[model samples]
Target: MSQTLISPGISVANDDKQRLGPRTRFGLLASITVTFLAGSSVPTPLYPIYQDQWHFTAMGISFIFSIYAISVLAGLLVFGRLSDYVGRRSVLLWTTVLQLVAMYMLGVADGFTDLVLGRLIQGVSTGAAVPAVGAALIDLNHKRGAVVNALTPAIGSAVGALMGSVFAQALPYPTHTVFAALAFILVIQGVGLLLMRDIRAKIPGAARSLIPQFSIPVDVRGPMIIASSLFVAGWAVAGFFASMGPRLIEQLFALPASWAGGLVLAAFAGSGVAAIGAFVTRSMHTLAWIGALGLLIGMAMVLVSLITGSLTPFVFGVVISGAGFGAGFQGGIRLVLSKSRAEEVAGVLSVAFLCCYLGMGVPAMIAGYAVASGHGIFDTAIVFAILVMSLSFIAVYRMISGGSRV
Candidate 1:
């Protein structure tokens, strides 16, 4: 009964034979991941407030969002590779501290630069957290089922998005409260991380380093490319829903920010159910293509909503698009996890998330800039939806083609 945390690469394949209780570990890992990811969306419902108070345009909002995603990417590129070298709990503890810094900066910021800087820190925290948390889930897994690891992250992400919106709309301190609550959660996580039975520092060096680890090995390229494409498309749908959906609701449907928050919740709720269904039935890949089609239809729905100016269609579109996003994202994770060894799991998942956050960040920035330059929000939203649809279809085609070849 060794209590040391298992390092992915150390080849202790037989030396570490301890069995972590499935239910307890799953619960702990799920809570940690949900908390880590929830911080990303804490600012979603408040962007409009920033816009009004700061007199910043939509592009400014996109820049703000991009800072978070970019930091996440940087974390993935650098810290993700290290998770394979270090133990998972150590990375999670560091991530919690980084997240606290991000929340504190946002809470105390007095100007636009402060907001951007806070988001940048937030992105780094999220980047650090994802690989560590995702790897931890896989490490604890003893079940024959791989979907648990994949679905756990998706479920956690959706719950994070949902909770952030609910609290932002319902809580008293609109600007400061969410960050404060998140900071409190991080403190709890940091403590919990310390208490966890397995906290081994696998990588022995003079100092912990932060350097980007790139260069795909020849053998990993095919699956990695597939995983990358799947995430890019799946996350593009998420980006549109996050960045454009709010503006569309405010302008077209005349809904309050709270109502828009509800829409965001509905999207995540629907997607969460779909992901659970995938987990139960083991339909991750099968349902993924269907979700792609759902994305296509959802994109068309957005276009129609713009043309007809119907709130119902737009709301329905969000839910539909969300289902597609969840299925594809989770499914892609399943495909990669199925092929990877336990040691490589975190590195691959980190790459997938890097693609996902990038998809979510970059395109939204483009659309946000267009909106800032006097293009109608409706026009920007529609165009963004169309691009997502196209990219998703291409990914779907690749999945289908690869399946047929196999």
Candidate 2:
């Protein structure tokens, strides 16, 4: 009903509600951020079903999936620094609005094209919102960097995947139901965000902020590259999981209607959440080791499972590697944040995310094309692991060799 944008720097909370302390506010904001990210991957478990019903090939499926990464890349390249010039609340609120529109599109999707459109919009909304939301968490809690960002998205992805898969299996409408429920939840989150007070000071000239800058100041490049490396490795692995995982499960385990795919994804994200929580107060250096080791072990397990056609080893691999993914992501971000100025926080992180999603999207598209070209899934997956595994080693080497700041 209210169309007002709630101009920047103004408190939206009522006088009585303003009495709540900063910690409570942080928790609320963090929860909202998680909800925002959770919807990003809800469609993961449903991919196999789409393939069957829509008769889309592996490349088609990969194309639909990869579009999200591309759209997000575009958003980041353009609007990534927007939150730096605008207030965090304004950026975050706009993300919710965009998310709501994406969810509605997803809920009403009829064919493969609709799925493509839905994911495309979803990517843009998610990309624009994440930097701001991540910045807000760090802004609220100075000590929070990787742990908060890692834990929130991990929790969100896990819960969203698990819930979407469960509803698809149990509900009457399946896809429609999940999207509808998500839209409803986002509506609630949107209201909460609208009512929340702005925490950051608003800069003037936000209206004229249209240069499309991807600023990587000289001082921040080393940490940014290091972060980008880890992000590529982490998200490349995710590319395998999100794009090919269900089909992998179906072919190997013989469960074509695969909730196992979602479970594996959940395990990956949940383990990451757990690891970050356990080491919340620890240094990024420690998390880097944990991430590297976990990734190596996890990738090995995944290979073994694929080779043997066993589900147990695959589950073990996904869980362990997911911890690595979470750690690498957080460690990299935290490492960068340690070097970042307040004004440059969102922009720097946006570049980091751009690298990460490129890793997530591009490799998976290749894999999809690989499958479409009649390559054995196991062989293609092995190649993917080899590339990502090399990065893991590099991360470890850098972490230990005192070149970690790279």
Candidate 3:
């Protein structure tokens, strides 16, 4: 089954035209994956600067952030399966172009409207590209691809947040420099993608594929349900940090350094990357259990830090929670995809990511509104931590009680 998926419908003549070896193709695709996600997070550390310059309300900031998630969801629904129908390379190329355009818009953004529009475009590009590239990775090497898919989000996000912070603090134009740099990288990646091959054959029903759909194969549904909590718990924590971490840093720790929020986010995401690498060899169930426990303990420490207004413990909590986030998310991906077929890759991955973005976008939006509605950042953080901790507890119970058994 895996062999067929990797070499579907390629004749001798087509193979002769292939420009890069499988290893090279995989490397390019992996880099593209990392870059796409990095672009999405590049703006996270810049949000505080935007607020300071434009004086946008917390609700307004939330709207800006949530708009990206909403657009990504729309893109996912509309284009998720298009790659399976048309081809992975085609979808990826077009989306990379869209991402380039988004970076330009964001670089020049002078106001809230511009920021919102740029984020919308960025979101759509991500939506369309995620499943295509994801499917392509699996096609190239299922085992490595799955691991790369699991690791890229954390790695990309960590790099983006940290880079943005560093550039913002050190460069002349904080906002413009990062976007421009990212745009340049995208340009290079787009050219590289042209040299790559689309291993998946173009199936019939291309037009119908444009219609929005979400599905998990019958065999995958049970694992999907079991992994859903892990998705929510992990990403909800991420969403909180991305959208509100900077503000939390300012309000709670009385630190006004631009790099502080980005540092915290980098630590959180970087730790997750480390955790995924550390536990990549573990069984899916074991990874899930570890992730759940990490989330529970980490969130508890975070809550304590918030209550005591201790920055050190808060940082420690962030790192621990980040590890859980990575491990749990990776475990969830492995669990759901464990039973999926090659043809089902795009749809399954799309649904899986849909759950992820929902977890990432919704709670942050709610927190934004809550803060705007007179709940202080600390108060909101406490409430958010408690909620995530509760979810983590549920995930732990589910994993331990054999509820996730397929």
Candidate 4:
């Protein structure tokens, strides 16, 4: 809270201390973050069903989806840097509570307004949770590793989307049932938070100041800017998968609404696996290029699927794209972490995540608005595919030029 910034790097006397055993406690923390983060996207595959039940248009669906991004952006701006001052546990506990509120709202949604409001709350919860959860993973590490930390959120997103979509589509009373499952998981996470021992390196005089400040050294700013761009591109890919894929599947492939979630899950699962592998491979440079290449190939695949009108190709394209997204995200986190210190972690990472949520939320909303007025879903989907693919190719090209390695 004080005006005096703690010198960067780990904020404690022993930044390298292993407070909890690496295996059990770390896994527990990762699991907790994954469960709730995944829940945030649990509703992705079911938006069509909601539309059918509520008589909302595609534009309305986009608006509802946009709330999550807007909420996440708001959370990052307001509370993104707060965890730097407060302990991670405190922030995470509160985030869990927010998720509960969101699920409750969604479980009983009656109209378009309810859907938008509920998604907004879920967005805020996830936005707050991501930085805290991500920072906590890095903080808990005795040995340096990016894959494990990155995979926590990456894999969780995939698995959660899969579970939520499959169960919601297959089960009776999806609206209530899916959220019921999420609410139960939130309760379980709350208990886990209570049981886990608090482990954080404290900074003297850091907590007293309440104002959120974002600071990075002059030299690091260039890399940070480029990292943010990469985040934007990757997140746009993710947003499309969540918002548009289900609708596309329903309209084009004639797939049952229930199986749409599987498409989202496949992409996340591909990305999660790639992220974990990237973490352990010890050649981050290789992984970075892998991400770039994946993005190019995956985006191309998506364009092809659009042209061919094949469901199998479309789903496959999504998974390939997701693999690229995860790989790129993992690489970016590694670059940021290597360049950052503990005091600066939340502030620096917040900027990158801000770009991500912006990418995820903004365009999707615009596309949604387009869909709402009796315009064709395919027209909007085409625009989305083009925009995301363009951004991704540009980022990859810049990185290939050695402008942004991550």
Candidate 5:
């Protein structure tokens, strides 16, 4: 049971005979990361279907969506650092099992209550698994790990939204089919985990780690704040698209197809993935500025589309803002992790993602209430775009004034 210390609080169990190779482990971990996120977003396209079937209001949909975020926050607070003491593989494996249960619940869901409960379970599983898998990736390769962490959400969301849409449109049982597929994938991922190595050593304080806390190092605090702001701005837009984009598209643009919502979400997420490659060589500060400007310009276009009642501009605006979302999020993550010690990886990521989920959940929930309370989608979206634009302006100013020090 010999172990090698990789950092202050992290260690590798040297059991080459029993564990998979590092490269193999990295690939598996990355796949698992993508799978978990994909599972979370798979429900986006199905929201419209659920609404149609159950006759729920916009506020009901928002509750279902936001409840997932709330549960994720609970999971992150309680279990974010558990892997830092127990082991990454164990945490991931158990969470995968929980996700499978969630998929089952969602797959067989008959109404709103079932959907809400399923999402809550799914969110908790995703929340607990995120920090574990994120830390594991970093444990393997710091630079690549950060890139994967930054890029995977977009990639997984894009894939999930598209898949769910296609399946919902073409398949017999819309909800059942997608969740079954996700559950199958999770089963494979769990098996893969059993074959892989646990890179981190089990440490003491496993019980104390259950208490909710953030462990950000002093050096990482400044970048974390900047990153948290970017996360809040970017994910709020994503949340809106996920929860309300389909309805907005149907109402304003006259596109009633099931795939339209998924396409809009996919475009936003896909553009983000593309932004990472286009701006990979840029400095962190420059990337942040570019992202902010992109958000501002893109949101302005969205406002125009709303006013003019044109779909073309809306599509174009989504692409641009989505690019900004991707680039800005990457810059924020790179800045935060660039200064973080290895020991701070899990805690830093936990706080970062907590903010990310908060941003994603809160604004969308508010918009749902507004829409349900008499504000039209167009009006609510206009206000939402304005708020995002304001945030983007602040982000740009922060980067310019702070310079490389940020």
Candidate 6:
């Protein structure tokens, strides 16, 4: 306990105002990234459960998932760089509180409206927290920052999908329990943030505009579009995994057990996480070709699985597809960051995320409608795969044609 002077003569123990060491601070920020992103997918495993109890159609499930994407896009469009204006710590703290509220809503949700509202709130919470957390992580450790940012969300979503499935299989009230558990973890983090020192200085004109801002800096536009297109293509598959992979597996393969669907998604994401590193070290053009090739082989394998009524080919397809996902997404983000002006970093990154999530959300919804309207699942997968391959090859050709260089 230490004493501090007050009014010249009075002194009291100031033990409550404790300061954390650097390692602890870094750990806290990293943990926040993991937990926030994990929360984003915790519902993936539970979607089936919701479908069963609520008696909703496939389109309903897709809409439920899509709404979260919309909420995130809206949040990023408005507040993506708010931390650059406001203090990062302050923005994180408030969003964390809202996140807690969202979790509580999920726990008690008995209706579709409640569920959608919770997801939207979650979108806002994660949306607001991600940029600040990313910015703060870089602030604390620039050397490892880029790698961490690239891998953390994929890994976190994988963990969430796996654990949510596990919890659903092992515990009661799968949806309520999973969200409640996440809420508890968030509470501890929120309280910790309240005590930790703020790191980012508040910039001027933080309150000057609430209008949505968007653009690609002119110099980086061509390369950014190519990279972002790859991200979009990869994320399209990623979104399918998160929203409909489980249901599709059940429908097509007659997979048993409620948790099996989530496991597939976890595998897909985990494989991508594993592949991100080897791909990131390559030149952007090389990454484009490799990613395109991986995606093609992966989708073809998935087609083989669908044709043969075999789970093995599908699982293998997931792995190869995941590698392409990692390669395309990470390579794009890395290239953009390498070339972005310091001031353009946050805004440009927002554009990248907007594209990535748009890919994740929009296509999944369309596929959902098609499936719901009696379109054959295998036929839809074939069409989607073809579209993704076309985008990937276009990226490769763009790279080859010198729109973007090595």
Q: Highest lDDT: which candidate?
A: 5
> Candidate 2: what lDDT?
0.78
What is candidate 6's lDDT per residue for 103-178, written digit by digit as tens?
9998899988998999899888777777777766666665466666777878888889887898989998888888
Q: Report how far residue 4 has shifted in candidate 4, in Å.
A: 22
- Which residue pairs show backbone clashes in model 1? none
Which candidate has the top score in TM-score? 5
How many clashes in each structure? Answer: 0, 0, 0, 5, 0, 0
Model 1 C-alpha lDDT per residue in residues 244-305, reported as the tens digit of each score:
65666778878876447535644654564575465446554675665577677776786788
TM-score result, candidate 5:
0.97
Tens digit per residue, CA lDDT, model 4, 49-74: 78788887777777777878888888
Question: Which parts of model 4 have CA positions greater than 4 angstroms off?
Answer: 1-22, 142-145, 201-215, 403-406
- List per-candidate RMSD values in Å: 3.3, 4.1, 2.3, 3.9, 1.4, 6.1
The global Cα lDDT (0 to 1) of model 4 is: 0.70
Ten contiguous residues with the weakest lDDT in model 1: 9-18
The sequence of per-residue lDDT tens digits that candidate 5 reaches over residues 1-406 is: 7877654556787656446777888888888878888887778888889999999999998899899988999999999989989889899999999999999999999999999899999999899999899989998888888888888888888899898899988899988999999899999889989988788878899999899997688888777766776888898899989988889998987886468998899999999999988998888777777788878998899999999998888989999999999999889888888887887788788898998899899999999999999999889999999998988877776766664575
TM-score of each: 0.88, 0.91, 0.96, 0.88, 0.97, 0.90
What local lDDT score does residue 206 receive in model 3, on the 0 to 100 scale?
89
What is candidate 3's lDDT per residue for 165-210, written digit by digit as tens?
9887888998999999998898898888888766766768989989
Show the colliding residue pairs in model 4: 1-206, 1-208, 1-209, 9-342, 59-368
Flag regions of model 1 displaced more than 4 Å: 1-22, 142-149, 199-211, 217-220
The positional error of residue 94 in candidate 2, measured at the CA in angstroms, is: 1.9
Model 6 TM-score (2 dp): 0.90
Of 5 and 6, which scores higher on lDDT?
A: 5
- For model 6, state the Cα shift of residue 203 in Å: 1.4
